[model samples]
Target: MSIQKEDIDHLLNLDKIKADEKNAHIVIDPDQCAACQAKPCLIVCPALLYTLDETGALNFDYAGCLECGTCRTICPHLKKWEYPRHTFGIYYRQG
Candidate 1:
């Protein structure tokens, strides 16, 4: 079956993310990130949470994370990785 943009959008809309305000499940080492030339996290994150600021510094928002562990697997600069606390993080609406 051919997947249209509308079909993808509809699938995305079915997922819900509830962020943990006080806790972030993923942590990247700035020192490591600064030294790294190839920042794969920028492209590998399905949630599109990773970005580079004007100063070329890496920035990430834990909110709306898909909890997919893509960053942890792809990022060598990652300092810490864990699941969010109970009752926080993504809630899949799809069956």
Candidate 2:
């Protein structure tokens, strides 16, 4: 069966993210992001974690990360990508 937008939204709503304020699982280089012409991470992230501020600087909020690693695969400027330590990350619920 083909999945629709509502289906996807429903699936997303079933998941939860518990952020670890002291440690982040992903890191990106701002300097590299600034020089890059194509910012695929802005569009490709399922969690919508990547964003651009009014000053044109890239901002990433890891709190809601799906741990899907799409940003790591898409962003050339990404400095580090790893699973969140221990008990902090996405919790998928049965839908």
- For residue 6, model 2's alpha carbon misses the true position, in angstroms, by 12
Each candidate: what lDDT?
A: 0.81, 0.81
Worst-scoring 10-residue span by lDDT in model 2:
2-11
TM-score of each: 0.81, 0.82
Name the regions of candidate 1 deviating beyond 4 angstroms.
1-11
- RMSD of each candidate relative to the true structure: 3.9, 3.7
Q: Which window of ten consecutive residues has the lowest lDDT sum in model 1?
A: 2-11
- For 1-95, candidate 1 gives per-residue lDDT tens digits of 75554664567698877888888888889899888899898888766677899999988888868889988888766878899999998888865
Best by TM-score: 2
lDDT measured at residue 87 in model 1 versus the true structure, 0 to 100 = 94
CA displacement after TM-score superposition, residue 72 of candidate 1 (Å): 0.8
